[model samples]
Target: MTASTLMIQGTSSGAGKTTLVTALCRILSDEGYKVAPFKSQNMSSYSYVGEKFEISRAQAIQAIAARTEITPMINPILLKPLGNYNSHVFVKGISYGKMHAQDYYKKFALYKGLTESKNSLDHLLQTNDIVILEGAGSPAEINLQQYDIANMKMAEYCKAPVILVTDIDKGGSFASIVGTLTLLEKRHQKFIKGFVINKFRGDVTILYPSYSVLKKKTGKPVFGTIPLIDFDIPDEDSLHSNPKQISWSTKYLNVLDKEINHLSKIVEKNLDMKKIRGLLH
Candidate 1:
């Protein structure tokens, strides 16, 4: 039987999609469910080689959260951008050589990347009790929607229930969330299970009134509001990282175990886990 899927999509890049997915993987694992983390395509300079295949370091980190071994299936397509519109693409952890952006989208992604991703996801669905999917960037990128295997298209392929997350640290969180939904076709919109407001600092009660207003507008509930974290978490993408922050020990994999557990506890306390689990089919 296929496992249940819960997809984490962001209002935009750096919106905490990876953080939520990582936390949930640990949470589910602690609950004694066999879980796996998956991202169809990841564009990152951070890479990890596990089981003799290279994949995005983010998925590898989430696999640790899940207490599972890393595999290429967890992140099948990795694109390390080279200069001048070209990216070094890796398919199933094997180098596919460098290709221009246009060719990657028009030829590789449209013709082959989606199929490869589906196959990997199918394997995980069959093997795990549940799979946590993390999406890249916003699903509402209209110009790239046609070749988007990382967001709505992937969610549709797996019939995964989506939880849209946004960073409250960024102003206009509500607008970004609502606008994202507004831009998507209704068919894609239906897959979203709810929204999560991340990196919040003030009293959560102060946000309650807004949640109701959001529900009134989008017909979706605010599933959670996560507080801004104090510690440094080596997240999937570095776009949002503080450039001046000191970095050191995360290089050693064991160092993240404590942080992962800490993250899980915080998310479990703040998030409506029962409702989130209910989203699984």
Candidate 2:
């Protein structure tokens, strides 16, 4: 049976996309669904080497949350930026050499990137009951829009319903959400199921009055608000220069499991998982 898909996209980079996907993976996995995490392309320095190759450490952690083995199939493209607009690339865990940013996006992204990601995503969809996709960054980047194989393009590929999230702690959550929606192509905008406000620290009900206003302005409801949580999970954004990698030692694995469970509980309580699950259908 073909699997249903739900994607988590953010208004901007570093807006809690990775953590949210991790939370959702555990949430669904706990309910007995065969869940898997997919990200079309990831630019990270930290990765977990599998049997043959390695993938982003964030995806590796997410696989554990789903109770599955971390495989390169989940993250088809891995880029390690080597400075001066150059990045070392890996495809399906094998090194594909390096390319400058200009050539990489202009040529490789169009010719090879799409095909590899499509095949990998197809495999996950066909074998799993559900696939939780995480976007690389905001889909509204006008400069990268044409060559964007990561955000809306990937979301469209799997026909995944998108939940756009923004960090409220950034102080422009409202405008960021509205601006992102405005920038997306009308067709892509229609693919969005709703929005989620992330990193909220203050009273949640204080933000209630604007919920309807947001719905009226953008024609999408605020699915939920995730409070600012001090979670100690391995972070892809912070792991760039991090010397500490995830240890598969049983002792470390147990701690990681507890962190995942803690995060999933908070997300399940605040985020409208019931409504988000409806998007899969």
Candidate 3:
């Protein structure tokens, strides 16, 4: 099957992009599509080792959801921030050495990192039926757009339709969506086919009015609002002790496992699966 790509970019970090990608992967996989989760560049300390290289824990969860094997190519560029404004750069799962912020931006982006990322993406597209690309941070960061390989730039490179996600629980959900659209160039904005408001609690009826205005303002459909789930999943970045450390061997994890399974059903029902299928085309 030919791979169609959809890139999930959030209004901000921790806006449920990872979870949505996981759910979308599972939904697509369950529907009989061979899917893979991709992130061109990821900055995370909590990671896992694969057969060939290391990848973020979030990517591993997404691969599980998609029922696909994990590969270093799924996350070609990894920047693990090591305190004191330095990060360890990994290109295609191998260490490229530690670098200061300025040096990394100047030396790597133009020289080799971007090329490696594009190659990895091309490989995934060739192999998968659908590629669910999860963008790092907000794509609307105009200052970083020129150097960005993980957000809109990656979406543009892959020719993927994008779904902008924002956290309603953080408040200013409307502002986040509109602000992101307003900040983006028209071409980049055009890539955003839909919007997703995540972590919304209470009746959705109250958001009807706002949703209407948002659609009118951005000329994009609100895909669906995802309610907050209490279960702990592997977060990309959090101050709390790593969820990756918790072994599934514990009795408590057995109950958590069932809840996580139930979560996929919730995701399938709440999201507009039909629309999602249409968008991929």
Tell me the TM-score of each prediction against the true structure.
0.95, 0.97, 0.93
Distance from true position, residue 68, model 1, in Å? 0.8
Candidate 3 positional error at 225, Å: 0.7
Best by TM-score: 2
**Highest lDDT against the true fold, candidate:** 2
lDDT of 2 by residue, 87-108 (tens): 8999998899999999989999
Whichever of 1 and 3 has more lDDT, that candidate is 1
Clashes of 3: 0
What tens-digit string does per-residue lDDT give for candidate 3 at 132-227?
A: 999988888888877878888788887899999899998998998999889998889889999888998999889889888987887899888888
User: Could you list the CA RMSD of all candidates, in the order they appear?
Assistant: 2.2, 1.4, 2.2
Residue 254, candidate 2: Cα error in Å is 1.2
Candidate 1 lDDT, 1-281, residue by residue in tens: 79999999999899999889999999999999999999999988778765667788788889989999788889989998787989899998988899999999999996789999999999999999999999999999999988899998889988999999999898899999999999999999999979999999989999999999999999999999999986545765459443323223457556688889888899999999999989988
